[model samples]
Target: MANGGILFLWCSSRLVRTPSFLLIMSLALADLLMMLKLPIFLIGIWCQGPCLGLFGCEMYGVVSVISGMAAIWSLTAIVVERAWVISFSKLGVISKLKWYTAIEVVLLIWISAIVVSVLPLAGWNRYVYEGYLVSCSIDMYSNNFIDKSYVWLLVFVGWVGPNILIFYCSYAIVRANRRNNTLMMELMAVGGDTAQNFQKQRILEERRLWRVSSMMLTVWMGSWTPYTVVVLFNATGYIHLINPHIGMLPAVFCKTSAAVNPFIYGFCLPKIKGEALKLLKRYRSTRPSPENSSRFPNSSPARTPRPSIIHMISINNRHASTSC
Candidate 1:
């Protein structure tokens, strides 16, 4: 349900023709992929441990790796986009290409993820049941050099690299917003003209972007950091405690991140929420009042009282429209 809600909002927001909306859509797509792949992992767990051993774990491993990589890459792309916007005060070179580079980037990420994931099928790596816990992952400690290389690649590209990029981008945005705010306040204090007001508005927009980017960064780091740290520990042979039950904890946390992203991207945006509420109220107001419906004796259920909430909503909408 979280995935569906986010996907709906992303698609709806895309009609607004804003860079932020486009970035939200990109994040939404990544969340959707994560949500879609979750059931497979759950099913594997339900079957009493990574189910790949019973039913060709190789295929599951490939798909999981691909989806996971794509999700990470999407996060990286968002960070890059935010950096470009903050640094250049425009959509950057890719955005100016008029070729829907965001969509292309998403597609390329998926392709690369798939290619990297399926390397095992070509004997570059191997997939094993890993002691029957219905979950599948790369066997990093295996004797195969290819398997070890694949694990390192995933760690570098999907985990460490993205986190570094995201952190840098978030810091840059925060610093830029602070600088812009200071400049705007100084200009205002100096008896600035109307042009300064426009500049102030632009700085405000930048601040808003920084807030959203920071929210995403916080969520990403909080959700995935534990899992990455644990994996690193295991890979280095410092912590030999590899339990399937412990694995599920990280997966659950990661999946919950997807569930919350829609709220972050959609309901958090004041304009989008207001527009949605307006549409909902308009739809409700078209229904008949309870008394009027009863008097008709043959009214359908759809013609019942729209509820007192509708009136309250209508008033709110009127106030908002007037205020605007």
Candidate 2:
């Protein structure tokens, strides 16, 4: 909820949404949708039945597949965009996505997810209670040939394909960064203030690339990869060796990506951090301190207090000031 609130502020205050930022927003939105299903799941657990019985299970399964698929696809798109920029555009370049282009990619991603999600309902396979009957998913453990085929199709089209694309992009970006480092070294051999400045900028780029790569790899492995392994195990009858409850660990682990992602990318962004600080300051300003209220219980609500923060600026030959 805090992440959602900060996003609301970010959208309101942002003048231009670059393609990267737009992709990030899509990621957050998809993850948010996935997390929203948790309460429904909890309710179902509390009652000791599917949220709407079998039908509710179907609904939950569909929602989970769609949202989870969309989140991964969005991350894939983000990686692709980053690679595109690093490969072709100048360092630190910013470009806004064309509205139509953004719309098309987002539609393609979600539509593909929806198409796969609904197949079970259409009888290509079916949703069934799984994970000790607490949740529903595609009947991966079914012996039917049709169900087996669907699982294979889902693994290839939904999971393997995206993983390949993401890894390829990451590799390309790393190669591009290497080239950039060599160029930076040649340009900075002079050893002066200018060299120091260029060296700093290059280091920042390297750090940003490292963050993006590490976050992407960690999230993919820590969340989705385990679930993918679980699904493969179930499909192959390999899950029989493990305790049923233990096999469900991956499903729960994947769900956590929804929570971990926002902190990794959202809070890490400079703009989001700025907005968060603003929110904190705004909240503090509206609520009174316990010490002040106790010492002067009848004090004026609108009373002016000494500034806790001040800003100084140069306006040409004149100076300007502001305080908070």
Candidate 3:
């Protein structure tokens, strides 16, 4: 959580001005909230039971679901934004999108997440303590038709849908890259011009976006798919396929996504990285260094040195002589 917070703060600083920074911040906030669930589950264990009781367990389940949904949706939104921006950069109007537009898109993602999360509370599904007893979640073992239907619904809408969108956007980006490369080669053969050079720059940005988006999708699926598969097996009354203790593995894996986001988003992009370095230098320069403070306890800074008594007297004498 702290890592995500620091990353978000660094991105929000004026040093990084890209509109996509908002998407990164949204993802960080989701992961941070998800990480908080660790303590909530621990509290349940320390008490030898569901520490927050039934109501607390229900809220915990809702929060976990909401955070997961928000994070995935934010990721998908980021991919879409990057793909759209690059694919249509030739259009003057499309290139004019502002940072606030990204904020609105993030808001929409959270709204969709909230809607899906609250469906259980509206009686479409339910939450309960799992086999571990340390955490609460959607009761995957329930044999009730409503529970089964809800699980499938969540699998499709929450997981499958965003993944499909991600894959599709990635495909679009790849195709765009291929076409841009062909065009660049043809233009170079004929002698490259300013427009071709500009296109080449945009192509580079698109390639970076494709690489990052692909990695984000891979990491997300790698982390959460195990949990989803385990839940599906449990829902189908095949719990024996997975070890009882191993059921919690997916939750642990999912939380690790929070740890990975700071590294991927902050350290990957060159523009953001250059700005981050500048920010780090500014931070070091502004902070009070203990070594410097102890060495100069009473003196004015060297930048504007104070005049000594002898210098003051010499100046006074000089002034008197001039007056005389």
Q: What is the per-residue lDDT of model 2 for residues 1-324, given as tens digits with 9 covering 90 to 100?
A: 744853675576564255566667777888888888778767766977655678888998898889888888888888787788777764565544566877789888889989989999999989887665667778777778998898888777767988899889998998889787878789779998888888888888888888778777877878877666766787778967646577566567767888887777667778767777777898899999999999999896687765443322243224323331
For TM-score, the strongest prediction is: 2
lDDT of 1 by residue, 1-324 (tens): 755655565455444445455555666666777677667776865875555453467765665676567667776776677677766673233434233776677668778887888787777767655434555556654646667777677778878889889888888877777776777676667564876777767777876876777778788887777667665776778656756556556667777877787687556767767756765687689976788877898755576656698799999999999999
Question: How well does candidate 1 score on lDDT at residue 196?
Answer: 74
What are the RMSD figures for all models against the true structure? 14.3, 13.5, 7.4
Kindly state the number of residue pairs that clash in model 3. Answer: 0
Estimate the lDDT of model 1: 0.68
| TM-score: model 2 vs. ground truth | 0.81
Q: lDDT for each of the candidates?
A: 0.68, 0.77, 0.77
Candidate 3 per-residue lDDT, tens place, 67-87, comes to 888887777777787678767
Question: Model 3 reaches what TM-score against the true structure?
Answer: 0.76
Residue 291 Cα positional deviation in candidate 3, in Å, after optimal superposition:
4.4
Steric collisions counted per model = 6, 0, 0
TM-scores of the candidates are: 0.72, 0.81, 0.76
